[model samples]
Target: MRGEVEQLVGILFRTLAEEGYTEAQTALLDTYQSKADTDREELAEELFVEVVTNLSYHLETETEVEVLVTAIEQLLSWFSSLVEAAPVAILAVETDGQIEFWNDGAERVFGWSKSEVHQRPYQDVFAASSDEMEPHLAQLQDGKQLTGLETQHQHKDGSIRDVRIWAAPFRTRHERFEGATFVISDVTEQKQREQRLSVLNRVLRHNIRTDVNIIHGHLNQLAETVDDTTEHLRVMEDRLSNIIQLSDAARHIEQLRDEGEDGLTTIELESVIQERVTRLRKESANATIRTTLAESTAVVAHELLPYALDNILDNALEHNDAETPLVEIAVSTGETAASGQTTVSVADNGPGLPDHEQAVLTSEEETQLNHSSGLGLWLTRWIVRNSSGTLSVNKSTWGGTRIEIRLPTQTS
Candidate 1:
């Protein structure tokens, strides 16, 4: 009797499709046919009635038997198309862990075609051994569903791929656990960006707290020692100013991360250098500023290139102990037009940069032993890197620190 009701439901849908049903009725028919197998007879009848009433179509549940066989052909075709073309990786595994289905998205994400992975062990996709997958497979066999399970998998080239997975166990008509299906999303780039931001936030917070404590201690000392308080007051003022500048640097870092390369534009290196040098000369009237800017040395860089140049220029004069600080700014083009790199060198006749501070910019990472003297250098590095440029520290010919920035020129 239950079989007969299911058969009757299929017949009704086939009849509806043939009768020139409204688009809404056809859509409902498609949904009904896909779910009719597991739907209870009462619920199926309710849905059928709703659709018929909406479309004003009379039910003909005893249609030709042949039409019932192919009633869901369109729905199955649509479902297959959607699965194959989905943006996320989707695959099916057998109870024994063999991959039974591999869709287009899986191929694209994993860099392996269906034919290459078909009938392969499910563990082949993961970076770890079968041991790593045993727990997940065991859960699937227990008829459990896994949602948003984040883990790393193996790419075809042996690179690690961070992914988030959703898995569900599929059962047979007899309610036996057969296997599981998995949907995976590639999140490597997203994960890296998040880690970068997290580390920067942590470091910035730590620096701010530590500096504030130092300033507080200095204030207490100043209150006690009224003798020769002039130098002490000057030191406190310097600390306060550094704290404010750090806040500004934090804001700049946030903007760089949020906006990314959207602000990049082709800029003439000569004009940018001239403008910054002119302003710096006015600000530091006692200092001698000289420039040898290369003409038509255009490069693709951020609009904030001037800000980075200012950091370099300011650091030069600020750290100098000379009676009259001298800064030399020079720009030179690459040797060849094709594949040439434009170079900007800023040299200061100040005491050379400390080895530890230089390591902050040169090293692959920052640590307690090697941290930036200030956020200004780090900010400069960030701007240059995002512009597809490189920054380096070397001793100048004048026996002082020379900071060089190399940037790729715009392609014609």
Candidate 2:
């Protein structure tokens, strides 16, 4: 009996040591040596063997019990390092929208330290609109993965940041709702880049289409008036002039690189609209132009403000069906305590744009709507987008198309 008791004690110490629980083994050894019993010796030996065998099976064979645990530990370590090393903000929130983990990246991106953000509600970290948070929370709860969600995020410094968040829900061993993990990256630069590209595409499409159509019409006229060589020569000169203008415009567009949003300058909104309206009147004798611009609305942009306004005006004039095509430019301004964005609308009594046309204009494939290839309105939309403005096509009061442009005002 004494020998069996000693054997049980030996097995417990051996199993604990093998598991790297050195302290547990030493404590068990002392307890077993003191509580040595002869009558229950056989039972203790059998129990000890069963416990060791079960533990070994758990560590080696039970995939969910052991493998998953080790994998999770490694994954957690890797994710922690990634969040700490990343340049963007990152956070892990529970199912209830409470923040469980906040990384250094979050600190750098949102200007909140661990002490400030840990275990707090995500809403407390930054001011978020219900419109923005509701949809995101719904997606997380549904276990649907979301990517590239663009919304405004208020910063600790009282400035607003345009942020894009990618998020997915995390589950526990029982497949129960644990929380959500988010990897947020600053996409402000990328958004600006897309806007710039859209503007360039719009300019190219509108100018190319208009010039090509003009050239085609002129050629057709020349063919009909070929009997008079003088008229043909005059038509040929006009076409050549159009070609030269297109070449110059192309050069200007090519010079616009994938630049950052740093060279933005304050621009007079009324002046730009007036210039475009005046130019359209002189260029399109067949079209009647009108204006209702506010006296001193201003915005921020590069030198492309004139070109963007020109594209909008040209689209309105070209698509109009009135005997004397009439285009109206209306400008207005407003302020929101939140973003304080200035709104300027350029509406026309032209034919309303098609649904597909609107979709193409807002999409990244805006270049596909080339005027030379039948994509004029699409390009105009691109220009509005590039200037950090919103463009929408709706039914005009004159039973035609209304084009609205909303731009952000420059901060004083």
In order, the Cα lDDT scores of the candidates are 0.80, 0.66
Top of the candidates by lDDT: 1
All candidates' TM-scores?
Answer: 0.50, 0.44
Residue pairs with backbone overlap in model 2: 202-379, 369-375, 370-375
lDDT (tens digit, per residue) of candidate 1 on 1-412: 2454454555555555676544645766666666676548666666655554544433344432333334556556656899998999999999888999999999889899988888988986665665777888899999899988878899998888899999999888687999899999999999898778868776886788687778778777776777655786778767777887777777777778766788789988888888888888888999999888877789988877878998989889988988889999999887788866888999998999998878866776778888887878777888899888999999988788999999889777
Per-residue accuracy of model 2 over 275-340 as CA lDDT, tens digit each: 777788788888877777777777776555566666667767777777888787777767453575
| Clash count list over all predictions | 0, 3
Check candidate 1 and list the clashing pairs: none
